[model samples]
Target: MKVFDIIIQAMLSLRSNLLRSWLTTMGVAVGVFSIIAVMTALQAIDRSVAAGLSSLGANTFEIQKYPAAFFGGHGRNRFINRPDITYEEGLAFKRLMQEEARNIGLKVSRSGNQATYRNRSTNPDVVMVGADENFTAANGFDIQQGRNLVEQDILYARNVILIGHEVYTTLFPQRSDPTEQLLRINDDVYRIIGILARKGAAFGQSQDNLVVIPITRYRAHIDSRQSVGITVEASSRSTYSSTLDQAVGAMRTARGLTIRQENDFELRTNESLVESFRDFRQTISIGAFIISFMALVTAGVGIMNIMLVSVTERTREIGIRKSIGAPGATILQQFLLEALFLSLTGGAIGIMAGTGAGNLIAIAFNLPPILPWLWIGIAIAVCSAIGISFGIFPAYKAASLDPVDALRAR
Candidate 1:
């Protein structure tokens, strides 16, 4: 028989058993849906994270007490055992690296603050970040209005502050502009010297809902303990490697680390952050693939069982075809094609459903929608392989049946 004729016959066979075909297809659909949805969500998250990291500046590096991403489980003493990077230590490093580095920014953050403007109070979940004047330069932040923090502001620990776009909108909605609005942080009032340009969202969280103050004021007023992170920017790309070395060395010296002892602090650059995120994405992809494989395995078994039943029910038809000079290869090809069509149809539907659902969820969270085309292609190929491999035994069984015996059995 011609290939097209065989294909038509296979499709007709599947159409005749609509219920069984649908059930088999449902299994493949479920398997495809599981992985496709997960992959879509993961890709969306990765894109958002990458955008956020880029917003932190390409040549910037940060010194912190903890790593950017930690995967291993921590013991009970993890918290208490970790050493704190003190303000004095940060200052020492800043002084030591001043000659080599272009800019250094000290940062600290406080949460759960209520800002009030004569009764119009903001939500308590607002974040207040204390940073140095160099924060704008090192962190890729642009002022929308008024002016950014200056050297004198950091030196004298000024109460003046810069507000993010969200804060400005919420606190000064009535006014045409928020550059002149005075916001109250806790009990103290601060003039809004500048409004930050909108930086969009990251990891499903808004980046425009923060208030910026001088790090010196933050240390003295909010938290007197230690600095949380220090950002460093190199003057030239040529000095990037040496600058990192100098920064690490300076930090080690400040922390009083001996030759035998390892440095306690973590240093993260933009490239390192991207690498960490890529590693995380890869791990998630592997996990998703394993889960989807298990589901597909079950679906494959279901297909095999259904195909076996189909062969047994069509024994008389098989015998009739063989009696009419139909070859075993033709019978095998027809059955295999039927199985392939069922799986491919199911896979196509699942891809559409998964992508739609994933995009809806991303849209709800205000993130850009992502469709993993590479993964979708892989899913289609996997489904086709599953159908062919699982349907082989039953197709072979049908092809091997004796015409007279099959006719007699029916």
Candidate 2:
């Protein structure tokens, strides 16, 4: 028989058993759909996370009392016991590394504070950052208007502030120029020296909802607490590893750690953050694969049951074809093709549905949608293998029946 004739026959056989074909297809569809949707969503999340980490700048690392990304119950206690990284220590590090490092910045933050200008008041969720003059260069911040805080501003403990895009809009809506506007943080007046360029959102938080002030002024007048974090930037990408080593050494020495004592500080960068994310991703990937495998196994069993019924119902037709000089291989091929057709059709439908659903979820989360081509291709390939593997026993049973015996049995 011609290849086209076999295909037509297989399709016609499926049409005759419309309900059974659809039920079998649904099994495969459900299995593929579950896996594809998960994989696509994960890919989108990974992309968004990578972008967020890169926003911190290349060749940059932070020295902090506590870990940047941590989980579980002891996190609060960890913060409580960890020694505060003082501004004095940060200044000492800056002076020691001034010749080797490009820029070093000291930073502290206060959240859930309201800012007011005239009668306008901002939401209580604004972040107020106390950072040094080099914070703009070290943390990838750019001034959209006016000027950034300079060395003199830090030395003199000036009360000048740079506002984020969201803060600028909320507090100075009527004013055309924010440079001249005065913003009150908890009733403490600060002159706006600059407006920061919009940095969008990261990890579900708005990056442009902050107000930054000189560290000296912030410690003396506003917070009156020790430093929270210290950021250091390498002069060149090639020196990143060496720079990290130097910073760690300087921190250990400044903190008075002995050779045997473990260092209490944490050093983190974009690459390290990505590594942490990978650990989570790997766990999810394994779980997804196991779930998909189980679903496919169930679908394969359904295909086998349906194919057996098809062979039994078509006994007389098989006898007639074999009596007309059809070979056993031909009978086997026909049954296999029928099974393959059902699985491949189901696989296509599942892929389309999964992609649509996953992209919709990604859009809702304000992240870029992903297609997950690798997973889709793998699903198709596995479906084809399932068809051949599960169809074998039924095909063999039909092929082995003698023409006269099959005809006489009914």
The lDDT of each candidate is 0.84, 0.85
TM-score of 1: 0.87
**Angstrom error at residue 249, model 2:** 1.7
Candidate 1 has an lDDT of 0.84
lDDT tens readout by residue for model 1, 142-191: 89888999999999998889988888778777746666567799977887
Which residue pairs show collisions in model 1? none
User: How many clashes in each candidate?
Assistant: 0, 0
Least lDDT summed over 10 consecutive residues: which range in candidate 2? 66-75
Each candidate structure's TM-score, on Cα atoms with residue i matched to residue i, is 0.87, 0.82
Per-residue lDDT of 272 in model 1: 70
Question: How accurate locally is residue 173 in candidate 2, as Cα lDDT from 0 to 100?
Answer: 72
Model 2 residue 102 lDDT?
Answer: 93
